[model samples]
Target: MSRRVKNPTGMRVLITGASGTIGLALGRRLVEQGAHVVGLDVAPRGDEGFEVIACDLTDDDSVTTGVPRALDLLGGLDGLVNNAGIGGPAPAEAAPGAEVRRQLEINLLGTWRVSAACVDALVASRGRVVMVSSRMAVMQLPLAAAYGASKRAMVAYADALRLELGTHVGVTCVYPSATRSPIHDSTAAAGLSLEGMSTYEPLEGVVDAVERSLLSVRARRDVPTTRKGAVEFFVARHLPRVTDRIVLRTLADRARSGAFDGAALAEGVVARHAEEVSR
Candidate 1:
């Protein structure tokens, strides 16, 4: 039988990005379930049940010191939810270097830094680590290169962390599909829309997944927040070319309709076709 970790009652947990939608959802749930929750974010807010720590994950000193501070505040950590991230759409090559770096700094390196800071404490507590990746990590889509790359890298990092931590620490990577949140605003600002993308799932479902990952003894290494995400993950893995074609078609139609700035997108499509032909 697979081993299991009990629900987080009376246990202390830390959630990064506590100001964001998913983080807030998870925090409220954890608090309701009797766990002492510590929240860390650049813009920490007043969460009634959570002790908030103002820390920028991208700042080396902030993460290095902030995590230990949270540990002190919470008494100790039984779980760490790495839920902080940013999102936007930009053609891969056309996207500014700084823009891509900003996402990577927060979504990938920031995650690594925070996890590293908390690893020793997590090991001591036999705690779980929940990484909030995205469905885009498993499947590439149009006009979102930086966002996709950061999420994909997050999954890879989680995979390695799980193996390394072994039985001492449980690591779960949750890949939430598009959700009804401010992320859509960012996507729109970046010149894209969700019209052709998968439907947004509710925030509660993603929170539940995080809870399950923390409590399940035999936790899955990779979890899709919904059935739609799971099926899409499978198709992306087994039928990549088909997925690519579908995405390309959608982008092509969007470009033809002048939905957003399609100049970069048209070039991107042409570039992709050329690469495929070469292959």
Candidate 2:
């Protein structure tokens, strides 16, 4: 069985990607609830009403040193939120490139590194771990294969972690639908924006889900940030063929709409989608 911290007051928590949209909001909210929150980010800022640690999740030495420092600051940890991640556009048909490797490095391995570092401390406190995954982890979209694959792999890591730590530490994965954030700036710059394809949900919904997962009496194994996301996740997980067909249809629509017109990375998908639509 997983454990919960009934009271938020004085609960020690560590959050990664604390400088980003979701991480900043989550850290601030936890601090407002009287939790001792420490944030880890590549570029740490001190004005967020919580202590921020400078830790580059992509660097092993940074995480190795920074996580321990966070544990020390809190004296012990009651919760760890793997909220740090990155996104970029990479088509499935092309050979994986730098963007693909980067997405996997920071989104998947970075989470894994931080989670591994906190294992002993989390186990000691009988605490919980919350993975801030993406809706793409379940329902993949076209032209952003790297982001989907990375998040899906992160979900797998969460599942394995849950099984390994179920007796001593609770693990939960929270999937949030697209929200307005700089994380999408790169993809948008590549002219592969998800604007029409993905509906943006309130960031608060994701924050709430993460908080609930950490403090609930029983940790939820998989939590979608919204009702729509729950339905999407269900369809993708249980009716994969249905999900694939839906995605293909959407891709065809987007292709016909010229959504991928100028994106070099999306050329293949656009061509294939056009051919499929004609037939």
Candidate 3:
């Protein structure tokens, strides 16, 4: 049975990573629906047609002070979207432990900080929390271990939060498949490519999924965006060995192609032996 979500008209929502593609798109759509929206980002583009709260999720004082300031500005938050995150393609061996810690801080710990700060306000308003997790959280792929692990941890955290919060607040975890956005550019900048992951789903679809998650009264625990993502999620849950085989085979193919050496490329190694053979 399809669950219907309540319209968020006049509801106030605060979105982290509000300057990014997904965040901006979500803010715009919520605004169009008559919801009051506030965005938080370290380097937000000036004047996103809504209040942009300057926030650094990694900084303790910033999150502590900034979240309250945002609550003050918005009067109260009805929903909080933990949308800010970073991803790159680096083999686990190539990734430094420090770099992995940074990703954990920004992606997982940052979400925790914001949620802790906003819990009182959200509880007061009986609000909802939407987590922008990824398909990688469910179905893992090679060369992005940190990102996948962080997201998996996020999914677990959301489940725990939902159980803890009970009927006081709503929680929804969104799993979007690969979408065309600046995230890919950011990964490429880090010497990683997501080209073979999946075909880019429409960005609008992802935004719509977030909206639905926010509005749903009895929000489902998991929200997968694309059909393929739904299938993978199902397979990952039901047929673990099958999913493992598929992922391993895919990684094997990529490894054989020499296209998987993004960490080397990022370090300015122009011609790998694998690339030389492929060429």
Candidate 4:
């Protein structure tokens, strides 16, 4: 059996992008466990439980300022969950140069700023870092060029940070398959939709992964830890031509299905997927 660290009740945790799906879920889970949680976001979270602050992650000053504000509110942080992200479709036939750059600013650069600001605190507390990444990092997915590339780079970044932070700072990178999150907005913004897109993992998969990381003694965990290799194997086995055809067909269907509202779809799909996976 894997070692489960004794629960650190009343310990503090700092969660970035707390307004998001997995972020909110993580925050609530921690709160219920008796941990003090501080949330940083660019927008308001409908979840009222966590201590929320409006901090801009893309700006260095904002992150620098956020550290103290978070530490002050929570008294100190025992963990940090970097979960802020955005997604979009890569226009078929068009290179996703700018969008990729933009995504890096938030996913990569933003993470850099936040982590740099929190390293000392994390070290002092012997805490861990959980980075929210995506399955696109492995390639072979359609319309996910920008999100994929940024996530790909983040994997390397997290690995290096983990090695450097060593023995003290635990770093875990989480990769989720097409999850039903605010990413639906991103897909639509990119002129794509999830029509005919039948596959997705529940947000709870990531929530449970990061939750385990917080209680972990070592500094790393692959979110949905046991499932990564199997999922990647399926993708690797499929040729690019086959994947591309699926993307084209899916996108065509999305275009025909009219606009999609993310919430309703996520609720119904997530329930079904969770039941299927549980079995």
Q: Please count the clashing residue pairs in each candidate, in the order shown.
A: 2, 0, 0, 2
Give a tens-digit lDDT track for model 3, residues 1-279: 146778778899999999898999999888888999998898889868788888999999999998999999889989999999987664565646766787788899999999999999999999999999998898887667788899999999999999988679989999998877766675666656777655578889899888888888776789998777788899998898998988766655655565546556333323433474477
- Sorted on TM-score, best first, the list reads 2, 3, 1, 4
Best by lDDT: 2
Q: Candidate 4 residues 1-279, lDDT tens each?
A: 147664858878898888888888888888899889998898866565978888888888888887789988887678988888877665334555766667878988888888888888888988888888866665445545667777878888888988998778888887676667776776665445554553577777768777877777665545543465345635544665665576556544453344333433233333444465568
Could you tell which candidate, 2 or 4, scores higher by lDDT?
2
lDDT of 2 by residue, 1-279 (tens): 245547899999999999899999999998999999999999877787889999989999999999999999999999999999998889888899889999999999999999999999999999999999999999999889999999999999999999999999989999998999999999999999998888999988888888888888788899998999999999989999999998877777888899889889888878777787679
- In model 4, where is the ten-residue run with the lowest total lDDT? 260-269
Pick by TM-score: which candidate is best? Answer: 2
lDDT of 1: 0.82
Higher-scoring candidate on lDDT, 3 or 4: 3
Better of 2 and 3 by TM-score: 2
Q: 3 or 4, which is superior by TM-score? A: 3
**Steric clash pairs (candidate 3):** none
Question: What is each predicted model's overall lDDT from 0 to 1?
Answer: 0.82, 0.91, 0.83, 0.72
Ranking by lDDT: 2, 3, 1, 4
